[model samples]
Structures are given as structure tokens and as C-alpha cells.
Target: MIPSVLPTYNRADLTFVKGEGVWMTEADGRRFLDLGAGIAVNVLGHANPTLVSALTEQAQALWHVSNLYNIPQQQTLADALVAQSFADTVFFTNSGTEACELAVKMARKYWFDKGHPEKVDILGFEGSFHGRSSAGIAAAGGEKLTKGFGPLLPGFSHLTWGDIAAVNDAITDTTAAVIVEPVQGEGGIRPMEDDDLRELRHICEEAGVLLILDEVQCGVGRTGKLFAHEWAGITPDIMMVAKGIGGGFPLGAVLATQDAASGMTAGTHGSTYGGNPLACAVGNAVMNTVATPEFLSDVMRKSGLFRQKLEGLVASHPDVFEEVRGTGLMLGLKCKALNMDVVNAGYDAQVVTVPAADNVVRLLPPLNITDDEITQAVERLEQAAIQVAAQKD
Candidate 1:
């Protein structure tokens, strides 16, 4: 019995064999309502005809080509992103962490090109998660990911989330950029207040610092907007995006304004498989589908439904759930006990979900999920809440 080799995550009693829309079929052939949707990667839902066709078509056409030459689809997607945001240029990566790394490099190199090579520090928040890469871990400034990993990477500073005083004090003459999640995804879905972000933007502008928004978990229409920072009416010098960019495929991108990308001229940055044809084709599909006004409206509508249902759960089991928070389809339930218990209960009852920091259970269902599936998910969640309430003795 070859036991599982990886360190334990939240292990479930069942394995899913397939998924369609917001539902998954287990190995035993029983169906489960999937609220997590692979942690919100499938914005268009599972086995989407659009994504499948894109991947299959591109697979038959082109799969792997080094970044040594121009790739049409990659350029198209980059053009779309650049057209919609403040960015005038885009760089692709294989995953979110790579996008973060590239964003960090791009910001520092922008200053370095201006002859200020000393401005290379990346300031990340206390509860931020930026992936497992060495640079990403260093940028996150947290011990959970950095513990015992030899010496920590230099020029990475930590500031408490939403502490303007600390953030202002932390920005030195050499600070290259301040990176943050417009909404803290892994840090318990804590959204940065509008005033705070606005103030931060003004402060950064005044201090000549670059602001990088890590929209890995909250971008690509997750917040009923193209980017979460749109709510603050502030534009970032560099923005990292992933998760929903490819619908279900692995892809990421770093977008930078023309001035912000002044240092990233040819040969400065590259990724071999980052802008491969297959990933770019699928990314274009997702971008076209999710960038619609109606899709974003549905996200806003479902978010209201989710909040109402979660509020009911909080009311029903006041002893277990404290409150519900977040925007759009990306919401959280703060639990009285361990969030893992609610997550496990949801898993046992055939409703997949995600657990986050601060005892928060993340419910990141696909944006296109129907009202019927939303009802089922809420029912299963209510049952899980009741079970947790019964155990609170």
C-alpha cells in the first residue's frame, strides 16, 4: 500500500472522478455539489465546452514552443489585458507565484534602470500567501512558509495588514514596492477597506513607491469587477493575476503600465512555457467569457444570495458561526471552532469547500453556478453548521 507521500492537507473520505458545471461525481458514482470549484479556478465551471474546445483545438495545433519567438495567442491575450487595464504591457507565467516573482523583479528593475538599484525591497503583509517559490516566500514575510528554509531572502519586509502607520514607516528610500491583496484571500477573506487603499495609493504616489496588487485569488472578475482594486479607484503600477485567468488551466500574468514597465524591454524577462499556445488559447477563452457585463452581473447577484444564506446559517447557529464576509462569489464563514471541522463536514456531506486563515471557511463556488446549486450548497452548509453546534459542548 503505497501510502500518500505528500504532507497532509485536508484529507477527504471520497475521491471525485469527474466534474460538470458545479457538481462532481465521486469514484463511487455519487454526485456532490462542489462549492469550491477547485478553489475558484473554474470560473466557467467544470468541463466547460468553451475551455475544452480551446485546449483540444490548440493541442492539435501547437503545444510547446519556447519564448524565443512571437506567439500570436499570447500576444492577443496580452493585448486584451492591456486594453482593459492601466497596463500597457503584459508578461505571462506558468502560475500565480511566477507572476508575483516577475512583478517583484519588474518593480525593482524599473527603479534599477533609473540608477536606483538600492530600491529593491518588497513589502508584503503579515498574513499574505504568495506561493512556495523562494522569492514568493521571501515576499510574503511569514514564518509558516519560511520556517527553517535556511536564511530568509533579504529586502523582504513585513507590515501588519491595514496598519497605515506601520506601512508608512516601513517604506524606506530603497523600498521598491508595496504588494498586497485587495482582498486577503488566504488571510481569511479580509477585504482591504476602500479608504485605506485610497490613502495608501496617495501615500505611495507621494513617496514615489510602486504599488503591486496581488490579484491572484481576487482578480479576473471574482469581485464582480475586472480587478478588485477597481473598487478603490486606484491603479497599481504592477498587478499580478491568475487563478481564473485560464478557467481551469494553469496560467498567470503580470500587467504593468507603460512607464512602470520601462525597464522590462526585450530579454529582461522570459518564461519558456509561460505563454505556450495551449494555455494562452484557454486563457483567451476564459477572458472572453468572464469579461462580459452579464457574467459580472450574475456574480453580483449570486453574491447577494450567498450572503443571505450564510447570514441564515450565522443566525441559526449563533454559537458556531460568528459572521459572513467577502465580496462576489468569494465569501467566507468565520467559525467558532476550527474551520477544518466545517470543511471536513462539508466534504463528508458531499460539498467541497476551502479552509483559510483565522478559522474562516472559504466558499469560492464557480461564478456561473445556478441558484439551484447554491440552494443545495447552503443546505449542506447548514447541516455542517448544526453538526458543529452540537459538538460545541
Candidate 2:
């Protein structure tokens, strides 16, 4: 029997009723430390007071005013993004997948309008995740994401992750863009080295290919920068942003340079619910707090603290954990034990985690988590590792 809600997800039995800061309360009133941070969406934290006030204040004044009319809040958010990023323009969407869709169209349309429609291929890498939309899955080009979805969207090609040589070999006259995640979240928290990312940017530039960065998971201060690409000191021609940008609200945007976005004129793309007052209101609050030097410096300090602790955790539980992977708050534990077992153990220890590919358990706590909370999180993780180790024994 198909469940009432369509059982597409292997959901956990726990039913969370309320969220506060870095904790969520189950229906039975058990509170779990939220290290997953809603899969890196709740950047500031669950029910963040600033975001709450932003949303509620906007909800009271106005909620929906489609893009047919001027939306001041959306414009304000876009201006802020432009001021902070390398983009010259922005288009709003409701999710990262939507952003990916527009990114593909923008790349293809740029070429089409320039009288070279043959330049439509988007070069991607293995172990990458853009989203689940047709264009996104096709762009990712992974077997797991594209098993039965074919005949899939065309003009997308895949290459080895971190292989600059493969990227060099793959670029042809027809290649329109090269898309990648600065920090791969679902591919097990793998971060491209700074030099490699710089090289990738150079390669794209030399080939005259637009660079599309999927910063949905690693952007907005998750990697101690507004976007992970900033760490490499290079910028993308087009960038897909979501997740942390909304501070738990559903909001996304595609940012592009003037040349890349030239083809997306008045009616090239839009969304009915994207960049609504409510979503942008919350997004503004998030950007105000996260895109600051003080806040980002704190995140960098906390990342160092967290990574040091995680390294010790892996050392202590040599049989349970292989190593710690990732940067800043977007950290992962590569497991020797089954990653699911470690996640299940975390549930028992009142700590929530997210499992990803490559036997990794992700720990994406809120950026504003306190020092004491960091210590507590590690203690709880240690408890979970002890449990997993015991089962092995």
C-alpha cells in the first residue's frame, strides 16, 4: 500500500514537534542536539529569533506579491547579494533545484543568443549533487541520481572529481559551462583543494566556458565564507545559491555576471512563489547576520575548534571512524563502521546526524552554536561512537 504521503524517503520514526536553537524536541518531548542543522539549511539555528521576527513581521505586513509587480524585499536582498558577490544580476527561485534549472537555461541561452547554439554542453564531475530536478540530476550525471530517469536531459557530460587533467581534456569547443560544488555535501563532504579550484576556474576561463558553482550546501558562512569559492580567490561566472541563505525559509537565487545573464532578459525565467516578501524578509535577516566579518571570523574559529575535536574523536574511536572530512561547519565523519549504524547510535545518544554517500556521517551544526554546545556536541558524538564500538565488540 502506498502511504498517504508517498513513501519516497526512508524517514526515521522520530517525530519532531518543535525546534529551538540547536535542538529539536520530539513529539514525546525528547530533545535531540541538531548537528545536521536541517541538512545545512538552518544556518543560524532552528527557530532563530532574528529569522522568526523577519518572517512574522513580513507575514503580518504582506506575504505574496508575485514578480509581476515590484517586490522591494526581493530587490533589497538581490542588491545585498550583488554587493557581496561577483554577480551583476540575480534571479530568485524557491529551491536549489530551481536555481540549477535556471543556471542550465542561462548557460544555454547565453550561447543561443550569441549565435553559437552548438555550445550547450555543461561539463560536470562525478560525486557531485546539484539537485534532483531533471537538469540537476542530468548535470550531476551519477548513476544513483539517474537510474530510471532517462532519456535524460541532454548536453551534459561527467568527469572525475578533482582531476584537473580530465577537466582539461574534456573541454571542447561545444562546452558551454563547467559546474561543480566547491564542497561536495552529498558526495561525502569532500572539499576541493584551493589550488585545484583555482585551476578549475582558470581552465573554464581559458575555454571561455561559464563556471557554475553549486554552493547550496557550503555557502552563506557554512564554510567560514559567504561562499566556498571565495576560499579559492576565484569567482564563478554563475552561482547557484540556497539552503543557508534562507535561514530555514524556502528561498533560492541564481547569480550571474553581466555576460552570463545577458540572455535572461524580461521573460527568460521566473517563479510564482520565489522571492516572496516573507522568504526575502527572512533571507535579508540571514544575510545581515551571516555576511559579516565578526560572524564569519567566529565561524572560522569554531570550525577550527570543531575540527580539532573531531580529529581527536576519530583517533579515539579508531575502529569506528576512519577520519574527519570537510571544512568549517560542514564537517563529516568517514566511518569504518557502517555510517547508518553511527547515525542510529547518535539517535540513541540524543544527537541527530545526516548520513551521506561514501560511508560518511555529516555534522552540520548551526553557525551560531555556542562554545559549550560545541563541547557538548562532541561529547554526545563520543557517546555515539562508544555505542557503535561496543556493538562491534
Candidate 3:
């Protein structure tokens, strides 16, 4: 029988009925360890009490109002974000794709308002995923993403990841901005080097081109930092953030410096349900928890343990895993065989993981996962490795 839902996703047969922290209960009453954390969206883990309370309280008081009116909850979230990041202003959106759309528009508008209306070109890196909007597909410029979506929105160019010289050459009078993911999540957990990011910043500054970072997947404390770009000691003129900020709720934000946001005036862009009171309340809860020093430090400590265990797992099963890469809880296991094999084996072991490009099995655990959970996750991976090895033989 045909399912009612669209067939866009190759979904597993298991139905998850409930969740708590890093574990989820399947319909058959099987408890599975969820290491993917809903593709890194469940930052504080599933069914967090703080988030639940915030949502419940906001739902009872207010849900959504037009952007024409003042939403104190939205203002509070914006203020909290600005207080912690380089942005002077924040624009709310419903998802990362909308944030990407706004980032593109704002960058182009910045140059246009500065009397360089011809400067509309944007440069993006290869192997980066920037959601599924038209601008996003063009910004990413991946054949797989742009294949069916033909005659894509133009004015975007691509450069090899980490290629400084290419970036330098790409910057021209027509270039409005350069978009990148500090850590390429869908590109198989490839992280841009600190030095490389700094170099890109220098090049962009000298060439007078804006830097737009797509932090939708790697931001909001996923990489043990408030944002992954914080690791490079540099800041983007415009940044796109989502996923973890909502703590499983559908929310996204575009942050920009005052000067960078100068082009955006009242009614330039807005979202009907974006930054609604309920979303903002949950965002506030997530920010309050993940933005603290103690919480971030715990993430780092847990990251150390996970990395050590992952290294050992790779060493023990050289035939299954080729290497371990990525930072913080956003890790990837580069596989020696088909990445799907490893993912399927993980399912067989009662664990959940995500598959990405470049033959990588992504492991994006919740920031607050316990040490014992980390050990258990590694053990499950070990079992998956054994199963895949047997299948190969």
C-alpha cells in the first residue's frame, strides 16, 4: 500500500513512539540509542523538561502574532543571541532554508544599497549543504542538489573547499558575498581549518566582499562552541543558524552586523510564523542552557571521551572504518566500505546514525549525553563493525 507521506526519504521501518535524552522507544517497545540526535537538532536531547515547560507555558499564554506587533519573547531571544555573538541584529525564520534565503538577499542588498547594485554574485564552497531553497541550491551548486532543479537561481559561483588562492581569484567587483559552512555537515563532517577560515576572512575583507556562513547544521553549540565559526577566531558579516537553537523545534535565524544589515529596512523580509512566541520561548530555553560555560565545558569533556573511543573503534575495525573526523559531538566515521552498510548495521545493533556524503557515517550525539552513553555508543559501533565485516565476507 502506498503511504500518505511523500516518498522523499528512504525511511527505516521502525516507528519511534517516545524519547528521553539519548534513547528512543520504538513501536515494538525496543529501546534504541539515538546517536544522530535527530540530525543534530535535539541539542539538549529529546523531551527535555526545560524545553517542554517553556513550550507549554508559551502555548498557554500566546502562540503567534503578526510581526507588525512587538513580540517580547522574540525580542528576548534576539537579545540573547546578539549578546553572545558578533551580530548586532537578528532576523528570525522558520527553517535554515529561509535563513539562507535571507542571508543571500541581505548580502546582495548590502552591496546594492552601497551603490554597487551590479555586485550580486555570491561565492560558495564545494561539499557544503545550505538547505533546499533555490538560493541554497545555487549557493551549494552540487549536481545532486541542482540536478532536477534546472535553470537554478543564478549569480552564485563555487570554489573548492579550503582553496585560498581560488577564493582570492574568485573575488571580483561583481562578488557580493562568499558563503560557507564552518563545518561541512552534509559533506561528511568536513571541517574547515582554522587557518583556512582566517585566510578566507582576510581575503574577503581585502576584496570588500561579505562573508556569509551557513551554520545551520554546525551552530548553536553543536561543536562545543556557541557557533562553529568561533573556533576560527573569526566572525562572518552575515550568519545563518538553525537546528540546535530550537532544541527540536522548527526555528532558524539570520544574524548580521549593523553595517552588514544596513540594507535591510522595515518590510524588507519577514516570516509569518518565524520567531513566534512559542518558538522563541523554546529558543530561549535552549540558549539559556547551551550558552552557559558549564554546559559548554561538559560538551567538550564528553567530546574528548567520544573521540578517544571512536579512535579506538576505528583502530580495532580497520576494515570497516577508515578514519574518524569532525569536532565536538558532530563527528563522522569515514567508512572503508559502503556507508549505508555501516548505517544498516547500526540499526541492526539497535542504534541510530546518519549517513552523509563521502562515505561517512555521521555521529551527532546530544550535547548533554553522558559518558556511559558514549561508551555504549562505541560498543554499538563495534558491534555494527563486526556485522558489516561478516556481511562483506
* Full-model lDDT for every candidate: 0.88, 0.94, 0.94
Q: In candidate 3, what are the lDDT values of residues 30-120, reduced to their tens digit? A: 9999999999999999999999999999999998896989999999999999999999999999899999999999999998899999999
What's each prediction's TM-score?
A: 0.97, 0.99, 0.99
**Number of clashes in every candidate structure?**
0, 0, 0
Off by over 4 Å in 2: none
User: Highest lDDT, which number?
Assistant: 2
For every candidate in turn, the CA RMSD to the true structure comes to 1.5, 0.7, 0.8
Q: Rank by TM-score, descending?
A: 2, 3, 1
Q: How many Å off is the CA of 366 in candidate 2?
A: 0.7
Which of the two candidates, 1 or 3, achieves a greater lDDT against the reference?
Answer: 3
